[model samples]
Target: MSKLALDAAVFSDAAVAPDTRLVNDAIVKALRALGERWAAPLPEIRAARLSGTGTFPLPPESPRARVETIPGPRGPVPVRILMPDGAPKGVYLHIHGGGWTVGSARENEGLTSRIAANCGLAVVSVDYALAPEEPYPAGPDDCEAAALWLVNEGPARFGTQRFAIGGESGGATLAAATLRRLRDRHGLSPFAAAVLTSGCFDLRLTPSVRNWGELPLVLNTEDIARFVGNYLRLEGRADDPDVSPLLASLKGMPRALFTVGTRDPLLDDTLFMANAWLAAGNATELDVYAGGCHVFIGFPGTITDQALKRIDAFLTGF
Candidate 1:
């Protein structure tokens, strides 16, 4: 685990406060304390660990669109559809990041609402099944089903011009994989763009895995390994493009906005994926935040404002 290639200042603007280091340290301390507290109760521990600390509180009466549940192959899938008061500019199907094991639509309401409001797009947040329960193809299957449903049913309902997919962390990985599935199997091109924030593009362990000691914001390597192990059953299944989009051909993919924090273990994953996409001759934008940690997009008013601004600009152009 060598030092990161870029400096911390590249990720943050001068106007923003310079407390990322301290804030990240505090977050780590809290997580460590929480881990210690939950060490005895393993069953309750997964729930607590997955329920991240630091959440952006929503207003008591924040306007939100209706939540609908659509039937999937396995069972009923939940989706939160947020539309503007009137006409919408476009549609965005958002995925929540929870390491493919934990996280829900409710947990991601604030971020999705902000995206819908700021982008003037109808955002549909999908509540997919978690792994070690539903497993690998199950989560992706639900996501793809929801996305296909959006493409087939969204136009008549919302009257939007185009559709795009976006998410953070595991959600981002699902988004990328969904795009690939939609392209290869369904012959549908619903998304004109994508926004991947701190996405784990590669499921197979990378050099960054060894650098976990230096990254205070990410979960330990053991936890990450456990996640990957549970997500994929076969030995070499992780390299499959469906699980690791970085291993897939990037040709004809939509223009993308890749965002990552410097302090995250997946920082290299984001950079590698961005470069691969660019080298494959696809239009891509990379925005790296210095001293920030994994899934920093959810930490609004902190180090994520600038990255969110960049995302807003990218989606608007598309």
Candidate 2:
């Protein structure tokens, strides 16, 4: 990538922290290479979600980490429940990201454990159904089931009333959708807070999505279209607020923390959502990390450290 071209690339966001530039630039290369070797989309999605689970150095099994399947509306929903050694604060519901087509609760053990340990919050990471096979309501449906189960069972199982839902990328979108489901249909808002990281809240491609089309950063907008296609059927209009929570009324929504990189394709999604969140008279913190890109929090480095601090601070209010 030439200096001028690289500067124009999604990875070129000047806002990225200096310490993060080195790693982010390399990951951009890796993602581009990954995108080049396209095969069957389904297998790729499955493999993408599963690839890092085995090798990522995990903390020695925190006595807190355990796996269980909770019953969903259709059937059982598998989940990985992580407990803090001190816990007793509240429940932090987690959904993993894989563009709604891939990702599992088990794959999120590292982050879940870290959250549970650092925040002193019991973390129940939901293993919601994925897309292309499950599609549309399936992912949100399972997530809803998990949220409902947590609201009812959390006090008894985890011993707290405060509940927060969060996820990264596609998982973050489901988390938002889950909140909508809980609020609109059930007339409940037991959730105290939400932490969303680099999510595409507008499947409709209303504004920023199109402006940043096909920029090869960590995520390709073209690939985003594929993920969206697989996740929603034709009848599932892209504009449905259920699919794109940013389009929904933010009034009465829980206070939220949205983190995204200035260069992330979804950058405007977070910014727009945060502004709307405040417009709806809700508390929101929009943390735009410098020189960061989508899913930047997952990588190790000073920037990740800074982002975690922000997340921890957000949780403090809850």
Candidate 3:
């Protein structure tokens, strides 16, 4: 059976192994815990700022991470580089998600470092500018600058021109926008693959975001609005492809693996983007995990384990 057909069995969790499940009871409890933490009502736009989630404890300081300040269109952008070993097979550019507000490159150390260590890829994670202060174009501009630097200097520095880009939540929006900028303006096709996870593709609040308000999500409709509002305060339009990648042309973009959960508020974003990619005659794979809230791949457990394994497999092919 094709992978799509296999999904039926995987989701059912009957004829498949333990690591893969569409819905697990543990995920439900995890979601509920998160809901309780965010029990306070949404803050006003002016008063809104990302809640204190503390930096993820730094991973083992091995393989040594290099923090560098690169000149971006908006002056400077910080990037974290993690290389597992010498002579990496490829370089992976990872963009982090925190509603374009409260996340840093080290937030993805657990994921990016593993990818670098096991997959023989150098992982470059961008610390893009946050919104409400920098907003819209600043985030995309920084990401674009990072991509441009990688394409120009990566081969000489990392010894590999083969690269892929991916992001989650707000970062995914920036990643997709960066890819479009690379393709449309620079005539670049350096990405061998793309991975978008639980991304908000539409800034106008797509139907999924509109309907998932009462649902217990790490990101719900109200939070979505606040993030988008903060981002657009400067100049991004809701329908502009850069702000809403779903509205962008997917033509000539690299093959992508799109992941989202059934209960995720951004479910429709992934579905819509995946369909558009396939419709544009590009390779696409869509995986929908049942009962999962927004961006569960980073969450520790069986589901994250399987998702990372899946990510590793996808990179092997690229």
Candidate 4:
């Protein structure tokens, strides 16, 4: 069966496994605890992150992983590059997610390295500027700069001209914006595929996000609004096409794989964006995992394994 068809069977009431149920219950409890903790001030949250409090263990950074500086709109942006054992078939530009605030490429090496190995592609993870200090155009500008550089230099750097871009949550938002910027601003259509997981496409607040309220499966409606406010730093800039790719023309965009959980507040965003992508004459795959909360792919379980394998297939297929 196809992956989507398998998902239907696995998620059906009669077919759900006990392990999956237990995993879902555990995820809910953990997310609720995290919700309470993340409700603290941004500084406190960042401090906890820096202190490694309440963070899960990740695999050690890959041996082949290395950090490099790339030219950006403001200054040099740091990128963490990971290469597979042999010559890579292509490149995957990864954007890390922290609500446009608190994530670094070095910290994401574990995930990026795994992707590099699995997809047989060199993974270049961009450490974009954060918000509330470098708000509005800073993060997007940096991401765009990285994409431009990769398009211009990746063949010589990696021995392949094929490329893909992807990210999760806020990073996914930036990835989509970067693709549009490349097409519209630079007159380039360089990426062959894209992977967006649980991204909030419409910063004006999609129906699912607006209706999510304070449930806090991972992010509450209020939390999303706050993050968007911090990034835009304006009252009504969410509607700008540059800020929200959902409002932009997606014509000439590359093939895309979109993954989201049914329980995620960004469900509507993925649904709408996938439809928009198809409407704009692109191949779009929307994978909705049952009982998954936001960013569930980072966790262990059959579902996470399935998501990762699907991602590998997508990126490696070129």
Candidate 5:
């Protein structure tokens, strides 16, 4: 593959980090080798690669962790709960990212545990339904149910009513949609803050997503298109506010932190959504990390540490 090239202005607002680019380059090489080794289709390969059953061992889960089920719009939604050292002051609902196809609540226990411990809050991670099997409404519906349950039942269970929501990649999109659903359907906006990382807020691909050719930056144009197709299943659903939060009314939404890497295909999504969130009278913070790729937070590096610090500060403030 060719080396990545972008206008210097493209990363004008990005953090000056040094290790993300190298880490992402290594990831790209591994991905290419995996594709060559596997004979399955791209979707199957991707699903298997991200299914939380791969060879990679995730960061360890917190000692104070448990799994439980709560009532959802469709049925019982399983959630992984992590608690801090003492009685919590608030609750944080975390959504896992996997392009709406693969991933589980247990997959991100390490991150959730850190959030729980650092923020002095109970962390609940949702294991929502996936696409090509469960599809768009299923994932969103499950997330909405989790949020509603947290709003209505969390205090009784965790001793606090304060709430925050966040997710990565497709999960971030679902988190945004869930917030909108709460605002419009239930006439509620109870979240203290939102952290959206590398979310594809617009189903209709942005210029960066559409124009990003095959460069070994973790995700190319085709990969994103495939993920969107799997999630939506049919065409013409891109404009719905539920499907694309960028097209939704951001008024009454919680204070949000939009994060993305300059090398990610969804860079424009963060850029555009942050502006829209601010313009719609909501407080918004944008963080662009130079040379970081899609889901760069998963890679341990200086940028990831900085981003987590920023996220911890953002959430702890509320």
Candidate 6:
């Protein structure tokens, strides 16, 4: 059964790893140090200079479809739309993960293109404004606007009735928040499904947050706290369901495919959200990679090959 498969996936990493506890401790220490350095608020001038770094390499000869700029409250937001060479099955709006503070559509172009090519779907990768500059609601708002534009325009532009939303890390958070906003504000559910990978669903740290501190993964509690601090101006708002979709009521949302690595600090957040969705009578599928780290699914041809395969399979079904 699928449940048994999921359990095996969750535990497989533990079965192979030796001295996981010791490895976790060293990971925590290294992450703490990185957190301290990244905590320094860079000037807008300096941040812009470093913006292009850490981006994923683009695929060679991947044809660029059309680049569109939509007006955001602050300014025009650039979105890279990638289309398959042939007719597409559906469309997907992708948000790239970077803890809500770093990373951009450019950095994730390769992954987005790969998804489009493999899934036979048109992908619109949005470059939303980052935090410490735009802050809460701004980033999420930009995403909502982009999604709205797509729903309103995609029918004529792409000739597709079915649509989906997806993202990893902070991008995943935006996707979930955008879904909630669309339901509440527009009274429309345009997406056929959604994919959330290693999402930080709960802004208010939970028990799982503490456990992530003990994992040897790329993301740590300290980095997350710093991300939260940059994204949320008011501390009390951290628990608001709009900011933290895990706390939101999961009624009338799209069917979801949740992915996470066992070593990812956000593993529990993904599990909690998926369980909540299922309990709410919504269809939910989960793929947990044992010993996989945060955003590992983005690393194509790497340890995350199986995870990406599962995603392709899930999206194809939709």
Q: Identify the runs in model 6 with alpha carbons over 4 angstroms from their true place.
A: 1-5, 12-36, 39-61, 214-216, 234-236, 300-303
For each candidate, give its TM-score against the true structure: 0.87, 0.89, 0.85, 0.90, 0.90, 0.86
The residue pairs that clash in candidate 1, if any, are: 11-290
**Residue by residue across 12-71, what tens digits does model 2's lDDT show?**
554456668787677767666655634656665466546643212333455677889999
Which structure is stronger by TM-score: 2 or 3?
A: 2
Per-candidate Cα RMSD to the true structure, in Å, reads 4.4, 5.5, 4.3, 2.8, 5.0, 3.8
lDDT of 3: 0.78
**Candidate 5: TM-score?**
0.90
All models: lDDT?
Answer: 0.77, 0.78, 0.78, 0.83, 0.83, 0.77
lDDT of 5 by residue, 82-197 (tens): 99899998899999987887677777877888898898989999999888777778899999999999998888999988899999999899999999999999999889889999
**Per-residue C-alpha lDDT of model 3 across residues 1-318, encoded as one tens digit per residue:** 113322554334354334433334455455566545334543432123322232123344435478988889868789999987768899999999988866778766777888888888888999998877888888889999999999989999898888999988888888889999999999988998988888989888889899877544466677788888888997789989888988988899888988877667888888888888888878888877755567888665566677788888888678
Write down the TM-score for model 3. 0.85
Candidate 1 lDDT, tens digit per residue, 1-318? 111245556645452356776667776776665554324443354454335432223223237757789878799998888876558889998998878876766677767777777888888889898777678898899999999898888889788758889898889999999998998998877799998898889988666765686333656566667778767854338879989999998788888888887678887789899888887777787777777778876664466777777788777668
Candidate 2 Cα errors over 4 Å, as ranges: 1-15, 35-37, 44-63, 213-215
Quality of model 1 by C-alpha lDDT: 0.77
Error of 5 at 312 (Å): 0.7
Q: Model 1, residue 63: what's the lDDT? A: 70
Question: What alpha-carbon RMSD in Å does predicted model 2 have with respect to the real structure?
Answer: 5.5
